[model samples]
Target: MIPVNEPLLNGNESKYLLECIETGWISSEGPFITRFEREFAATVGRKHAIAVANGSMALDAGMMALGLEEGAEVIMPSFTIISCAAAIVRAGCVPVAVDSDALTWNIDPTKIEAAITPKTRAIMVVHIYGLPCDMTAINEIARRHDLKIIEDAAEMHGQTYNGQPCGSFGDVSIFSFYPNKHITTGEGGMIVTDSDALADRSRSLRNLCFLPARRFVHEELGWNMRMTNMQAALGCAQLERLPEFVERKRAMGKLYTELLQDLPGIQLPLPETSYARNIYWVYGIVLKDEIDFDAAEAMKRLAAKGIGCRPFFWPMHEQPVLQKMGFFKDADLPIAAKLARRGFYIPSGMALREDQIREVAGMVAEVIR
Candidate 1:
């Protein structure tokens, strides 16, 4: 089967890893980790970047940095990975799901105002599928409410808004280094921000809340969320190739658009112009009601021909866990819910070649033909 994603390694990753091994600095405390953080901060246009064990931990640290009181509500898009909510919950905050815009598949910035309450402490906006969210509107609303904006920019490494990189716009932003990401370290994550306090807090938290490197000067309770030297080595190498990776992903997206444009009843997702680049981390397709095949049937048909297909993330408000909590009231997010039900993404890996794209395109046509 054509896999959903692949990690392309053209960096001096092996060399860096070998250097780490030679120096006996395989642990989180190593030169490459610091170098990775510094270089990444510069690349993303952030004041500081703190390396973490994974993207989820980066989110968790971001929430913690906000210092929300217990039960404080965090407004976020329902159409996002569970990691967004999981991180909020981990930091003793409640995840308040809001519907997103159908076009951008991003949190509806206009809807954010209504979700805010006296207890609402933060707003976490996710750039779903590497499509940039309406940051201008979102940022304005956040400023009016004196609310903190946390960007879950994991899937949008090279994406930007109004010339500002996604990770640099929000009050705090997180990036993922999983294999399928724009860049990878097998399994790693990073947090970036303009706030010195948040940056310092993140560094401390990732290293067990140690004061300037711990070693018995522990101040607050923290976790072992540090990224290892090995991960950093890969991350450093991946950084060098990130721009090309994004360009390749966009090229594939354009190809998919051409291939799928003529299909009746198949609605394609478009990138918002606000985004400097829409790197197609995954290509989402929505089958209209008039379509003969629903999302499930489409997936089954495609899989038979050795193609991989998957549905969108089930809206957080509809998930059984949240439903049981009675936390999910009438979310009024019709667009997001509908998209969740019928939307599915196909393979759009940067590593996928022209012939591979053609093959996947053919399989898609056959599935819904």
Candidate 2:
């Protein structure tokens, strides 16, 4: 089967891992952790980078470091993963949902101001799929309102926005290093920022908020979300090949576009926006409104043909857990809801070859058309 994603680990991954084992420095306190954090910070143009256990923990640590007042609202894309809202809620804040752009599929900046209120403290800018949210407009809104920006760059590892790196936009930005991502640590994440205070706070939050002077005494609660040296070793190796991996993804994207550009009953991902070219984090396909079936049915058909696929994020406004919490009761994000129902992505991993891209594209065409 042509799986949705498979990590490419042809770099010095094995060598670094063997070094970690040979040196018996496999714990979180090992040297590779610091080296990974430092190199990642430099790559993302951040002053500091705090390594964490995973993406969800990165979000949790990042939100806690913000220290926002309870009940303050955070405006975010409803099309994003539930982790964004969960992090805000866990940090004692409310998440305000916004619709996505029809073309770009990122959060609609035009709808943001309408969601802002007196209690609004931040805008959680989630760079969805391949392209980034329009940072130029979002930055303007945040500046005018004096709101904090938390950039979720989970899917955009090597992406930039208008010549600036994506993870450098917000007060705190996060990345996930899952195997499906451009870079992989097997399971890891990083929180990066220019503020020393935020960086220190994130580090403390990832390590259970231990006091520097005291060993077992903690003034505030935090999580044990530290990344191990072994994971950092893998991360360092993956980081070395991020640029090459990005090019490969783009090459696959270009091939898919060529193969299925004219396929009926589907909307292809836009290759580029005015600000930035798509990095094609995943080769997302949105079934046109005229299509008889939803993404779920389409995915089933693709699977029958040995083409593995995955559905898009369900809108946060429609989440059952959030519904139970009495949030987004009156939300009306039509675009996000429609995308959730119709969108799914095919094979677009780092290890995907040109032949697999053609086969997936051909199968998608046969299934959807």
Candidate 3:
């Protein structure tokens, strides 16, 4: 089967990892961790960056570092991964979700104000797929309301909005280095910010709140979410090749669009918006109403034809875990609900070859034909 994603590791990933093993500096205390954090922060135009075990943990750390009051409402998109909402909940805050823009698939900036109340303290902007949310508009809203912005740029490693970087917009922004991301450390994440206090708090939280002056004494509870030195080694190597990797992703997106443009009954990812071109983190296809099957059935058929597929995120409001919590009382996010039911992405990884793209395109057409 043609796998949905296969990361390309042609750079110095193995060489850096060998150095880590040879020097016996495989733990989080090694030099590569600091180097990686510094370089990554510079790349994203942030004052500081804290490395964590994974993207979810980075979100947890980022949210806690905000130090919002208990029960403070954080406005976010209903169409994001559960991690976005889970972090807010873990930090003792309520997530007031807004619907996605029908075209952009990012948070609807227009719907944001309606969800804001006196309890609202932050807006968590999650850039979806490869496109960024309307930061110009979102920033204006946050400025007027005096709300903090927490950007999730996991799917956007080398992407920019207008001319500025995606992770540079919010007060505290995050990036995930999962295997499928533009750059990967196997599994890792980062928290970046311009605020010194926020950076210090995030570092303390990731390391279990151990006071620097009093090593073992802890004043506040925090998680052990530090990324390993080996992961940082890999991250440093991957980060070197980020520019090329981004080009590869964009090239892959273009080829897929060219091949699948003739196919009916499905909608392709938008190549570019007014502000920025899509990096195409994953090439997603949403079935039109004429297609009588849901994404689950589409995946099954694709699997039967020796092609791998993955579904879009299930909306937060429809989650059984949150439903049990009595959230989303009579929610009405139709676009998100429909996208979840009909959307799935085919193979679009750095390792994918031109012939494989052709094959996948053919199989997709056959499945929907």
State each model's C-alpha RMSD to the native: 1.6, 0.6, 0.7
lDDT over C-alpha atoms for residue 214 of model 1:
48
Q: Write the per-residue lDDT of candidate 2 for residues 1-369, one digit (tens) a residue.
A: 999999998889999999999999999989999999999999889999999999989999999899999999999999999999999999999999999999999999999999989999999999999999999999999999999999999999999999888899989999999999999999999999999999999989988889999968999999999999999999999999888888888888888999999888888999999998889999999998899999999999999999999999999999999999999989999999999999999999899988888888888888876
- TM-score, model 3 to reference: 0.99
Per-residue alpha-carbon lDDT of model 1 for 34-74, expressed as tens digits?
Answer: 99999999998998999999999999898898788999999
- Give Cα-based local distance difference scores for all models: 0.86, 0.94, 0.94
For candidate 3, give the lDDT of residue 289. 95
Residues 1-369 of candidate 3 have per-residue lDDT tens digits of 999999999889999999999999999889999999999999999999999999999999999999999999999999989999999999999988789987778899999999989999999999999999999999999999999999999999999999898899978999999999999999999999999999999999999999999989998999999999999999999999999999999999999999999899999999999999999999999999999998999999999988999999999999999888877889999989988998999998889999999999999999999
Model 1: colliding residue pairs: none
Ordered by TM-score, highest first, the candidates read: 2, 3, 1
Question: What's the true lDDT of residue 16 in model 3?
Answer: 95
Alpha carbon lDDT of residue 170, candidate 3? 78
Better of 1 and 3 by TM-score: 3
In order of appearance, the predictions have TM-scores of 0.96, 0.99, 0.99
